[model samples]
Target: MNQHVIRPVRADEWEKVKELRLAALRDPAAPVAFLETEEAAVGRPDAFWQERTEGASHGRSARQFIAEAPDGTWNANVVVLVEEAGTVGIFDEAIDVDQGHLVGVFVRPEQRGSGLTEALFEAALEWSWSLEGPALDRVRLFVHEDNARAAAFYRRFGFEVSGLVVPMPTDPSAKELEYVFPRPAAN
Candidate 1:
């Protein structure tokens, strides 16, 4: 396994962020794992990328973490979004409590099974639980029903199926399942 450094993305690393996202969109599992298309992402302007990076990098309500290889290449990334109570979530469900929503998870083919994914989630969950003003009650993620690989990984990470399923916005014939990691019990 290659050595990697896992860290939160910096606001100025918009270029690297954009590059990694585009690469993710090109992966074979992208269609089922991500809502965005490579075409849409490629058509976006630099300003959009800059704003996105800034929001995830500097905003208190969200964060994007990346695993950088020894040579400085980003091989994996995950974004966590804070959902406040009483708000509508990405799946159109009402948020019942303060929570963290994990999204945009991707690891390069070469880095899969190297423990990078676990490390990324560890950092994200730690950050979510450590928030002071509005601590999260749980961290959640949506996985397409057909993406068994992702679902298994999530389950292995202690995220249980929440029994809430939603139709894919772009393709209602398909569905996504909600998985959640409830806040760990206080020690």
Candidate 2:
């Protein structure tokens, strides 16, 4: 377990970002943790990666952070999506929650339990909390029901189940649970 410097994704590093995403998709837990498959990701064009990375990294509505090991290898990543007051969930329910939706969470298996995940979460949550007044009141993430490791990590990080479960769009027969961490009013 090495110390990884967690920082916002750089605009010029889209290629590396694409590589990490594809690697994550190839992980054994991809079926439960990620919607994208290796085959599908590998088929994407360079422009897609460039646009996706630039938009996500520099876009005001969202932010993506990456963890890079001392050797220059990416160890993990997390992206935060800001949900506005009148937005709606994938299920079409009004997204009155006004929250930060965490997505694209991944930690390389070799780096698991090295505290890098916690550091990544801290960086992400700090960014989410740093938003302007009335920007975002809470942070939420969906965890597949069978991904107990992720659920446990969320709980350890002070997140609690919101009692909302949505069937995964990629696999309607499967379900995922939404966990949330409300920002303190004083934040």
Query: Which 10 residues in a row give candidate 1 its minimum summed lDDT?
Result: 53-62
Q: Could you tell me every candidate's TM-score relative to the true structure?
A: 0.98, 0.94
Model 2 CA deviation exceeding 4 Å by range: none
For all predictions, the C-alpha RMSD in Å is 0.8, 1.5
Local accuracy by lDDT, each model:
0.95, 0.87
Winner by TM-score: 1
Tens-digit lDDT track of model 1 for 11-55: 899999999999999999999999999999999999999999999
Error of 1 at 176 (Å): 0.4
Residue 42 lDDT, candidate 2, scale 0-100: 95
Candidate 2, TM-score vs. the true structure? 0.94
